[model samples]
Target: MKTKRIILSALRSLGKNKLRSFLMMIGIIIGIIALTLIVSVGFGAKKQVMERVNKFGAESIMIRAGGGVQISQMSANQGTTTLKLADAEFLENIIPEIKGVAPFSSKGNTDIKYFEKSATVGLLGCTPSYAPVWDWNVTAGEFITDEDMKLLNRVCLIGTTVQKELFGDSYPIGEQIRIDNIQFEVKGILEPKGTSPGGGDMDNRVMIPLSTFMRRVANIDYLSAVKVLLHNPKEINTTAEKINQILRERHSLAEGEPDDFTLITPTEATEMAEKVSGTFNLFLALLAGLSLITGGFVIANIMTISVNERKKEIGLRKAVGASSKKIVLQFLFEALAITISGGVIGIVLGGAGAVILGIVMQIPVSVSWASILTGVISASIIGIVAGIQPAKKAARLNPIEALK
Candidate 1:
């Protein structure tokens, strides 16, 4: 009953100066808002990144024609065309862990024309296994076949972006498009893949037979990269090592010579993405924490000021029958009321802001219950910590001295 009265007294005291109470809570509100936004955005980004990384299939591995270590997806050395079709065949035939192999060469920023319409797009030459290796499916018609490669057929598959650019609403299949003045029949339309992890448009390319590209366009036997799908994802490291040993022997690299090819596994790609996201989230979290600490200081200052200003009220309560413990409890309860109210308001505003930002920016935002609980608990802790000294001071004031 006495505790209830103390709580009511604290509420009444805060109500006396609504503006000051609101001002005291402003720091906590900002801190909680920052915390909620950072957590939600971080989670969304990590999820989106992981999804992008897994687009290549968790069991897949890529061997790019490069000498240096490949840290990022877009950093693979495109100039080094050491990888060959024969190398892909060799790996598939020799490595028991390999399920599928796709050897492909690419020429980017090439102009394609269908009558008056034209678009600059990427041109890829790949085998039929490329589709299965990359988990790509044709929305219509079919991908390149072994016969197409054997006969060096000038047939191509266009991505959705290229389809829209060149053909528009007209049926693209059975239509012919000229690449560098050479006409190739469109055999299929590829499903939309949106964007690559490197932020490139995945559905802005045209794919044709490897032989056709080699004979007509590139006029080179070397491949740009080879994608391999493993029987099991757990064997990626072992398979990569075996592939490295074979390639080193085939290339006749001496004991000290560096590898001519770079091996990139899906696991490595996912790890790299996770590491980047984790670092960013950590930085944001630290900034939010600093904001919260600053808010705590603001709260402490306000509470201290309140204690000084309410000295007479404290003395009056003590002159009656109120104990020192009750005085401390009253002040603590007031601090908690302010912080809790601020935290609730901040959470609602932050969540709404996150959703609005995501829609405007075309980014994903995921709000977890954990974030809400954390924000509330953090606010409560800050309030308690900030109010402790002031509460103690108020409790220890002599009735006569405080009254004077």
Candidate 2:
């Protein structure tokens, strides 16, 4: 009952100076808002990456032409020609876990035309194993064959987006499309893959035999990447290490020399996501920490001033038999009330901010229970730490001198 009275007394004091109480809480509100945003964006972005990795194939690994570069290896945007089809074949022949290998090269934004209509799309040159390796079979007609790749045939497979853009509802299996002024017969329509992890449209490209792509289109003898489908996912790390050693020996790189090729597995994809999000989140955390510290100092200073100004009130309460312990609790409760209110407000706004960011950035964003719990705990801790000195000061005043 006495504790309830002290809490009520603290509320009443805050109500008398609403503006000052809000000022004390503003810093906490901002800090909690930033903290929640970091968690929401970080988790949501990581979820997006993991989802793509799952879709890409849990048992798959990719070897890109470049070691490391600014552009992502997933997008098939690497310009290096260090990786080759022979390297892919060599790995498959020796590695026991390898089920299939599909060496491929791609060129983004390739211009193609169908009669009067034309569109720009990704152009992929892949071997016959591409279908089984990717688990992505054509929905209609037939996929490329060894004969087509061997003869450097101009046969092609079109994705749904390309079909919709150039062919529209018309029967497209036997239709011809021109890529780089070279007409190719459409053998099949690829199943739609929707959006990629990096936000590119996966179903907006054309696939042809790698031989045709190298000799006729790009005029390159190198591969952009090699996709290896493993029989056992549990032994992936060992398999990847074996692949690395083989590639180094083939390339004739000395010890300690950087690898020309880069390996990307499901685990590496997740780590890539963590590194990206971790770096940005680290910066945000510092900002949030600074705001909380500033808010703590604000609370401490405002509260200390409030203690000095409320001398008459303290004196009257002590005269009326309010104990020193109750005096300490009352002031402490006031600070707690302000911070708790700020935290609630911050959480509500933070969730809304996350939604706004999702729409604006066109990426996933989610608020978790963990973020809310963190906000509540952070606010409470700041209030207790900031309130101690002021509460003790209010409690130690001489009743006679204070009343004067």
Candidate 3:
């Protein structure tokens, strides 16, 4: 009952100086807002990155020709030319966990023409198994076949972007298009794949037979990369190691020599994204923590000033038989009231701001209840820490000295 009275008295005292109370809460409000936004944005970015990584199929692996540091499966190679169709075939035969392999070569920014329209687009040469390996779908007609590869047929599949640029809405299947001055029939239209993880257009290319690419477009015997699909995604690391060993033996590399090719799995890609997101989140958390600490100092200063201003009140309460503990509790409750109120408001405002920012910036933002709870709890802790010294000072004041 005495505690209840102390709390009520604290509330009444705070109510008498609403502006000062609100000012004291400003730091806490800003800190909680920063913390909440950081958490929500970090979660959303991580989720988006994972989704993008998974789009390449979690059960798949990619082998690109070259050595040195490689961040993603899509990383292009220039130094090594050892990776070939034979290497892909050998790995598939040796690794029982391998489901399928699609060896492909690419020519970048080649001028392709149909009728009077022309566009510079990427030219990919892939085998019949490429569709199944990448889980790609043909919107119209059929993908590359063994017969086309065997005959080195001039049949190609155009992506939606190419189709739109060349044929517009008109059916492109069976239509003849000229790529690098070589005429080829459009056998199929690729389904839209939107954008790559690197923000490049996925559906802005053309795919032809691997044999045709080797003989005509790129004029290279070596493959650019090999897409490998695994029966079990969990065995990605083991399978990748096996593939590395096989490739090393085929290339006849001696002990301690750096690999001539790079192998990347979906798991690796996801881990990279996770690491990047974690770093970003840590940086954001540190900044927010600094803001919170600054806010704590503000609260502490305000509470100290309040203690000085209410010296007479403290003396009056002590003269009326109120215990020093009651005075301490009263000041602590007042600080908590200010911080808690600010935290609540900050949470609402922060969540709303995150959503608006996400929408405006076209970035993903997901607010969780855990983040909200953390903000409120952090505010409460800051309040307690900030009020402690002032509370103690107020409690220790002599009644006569305070009254004087």
Q: Give each prediction's root-mean-square deviation over alpha carbons.
A: 2.1, 2.5, 2.8
Q: Per-residue lDDT for 373 in model 1?
A: 92
Q: Which stretches of candidate 1 lie over 4 Å from their true place?
A: 1-4, 69-71, 74-76, 359-364
Runs of candidate 3 exceeding 4 Å displacement: 1-12, 73-75, 165-168, 318-326, 352-364, 399-401
Q: What are the Cα lDDT values of the candidates?
A: 0.88, 0.90, 0.88
Predicted candidate 2 versus true structure: per-residue lDDT over 269-305, tens digit per residue: 8787789888998999999989988998999999999
Clashes in each model (backbone N, CA, C under 3 Å)?
A: 0, 0, 0
Candidate 3 Cα lDDT to native: 0.88
TM-score-best of 2 and 3: 2
lDDT of 1 by residue, 1-404 (tens): 28888889889999998998999888888889988988888889877877876887788888988876554655335678778889999999999999999999988888999999999988899998988888897999988998999999999999999998887788989998999899999999999999887778989989999999999988988988888999999999999999999999988889999999988887788787778888988898888888888888887888899999999999988998788988989989999998988899889888888899899998878888977998899899988988889999999999999999
Better of 1 and 2 by TM-score: 1
Candidate 2 TM-score over all chains jointly: 0.90
Best by lDDT: 2
TM-score of each candidate structure, all chains considered together:
0.93, 0.90, 0.88
| Of 2 and 3, the candidate ranking higher by lDDT | 2
The stretch of ten residues in a row with the least summed lDDT in candidate 3 is: 69-78
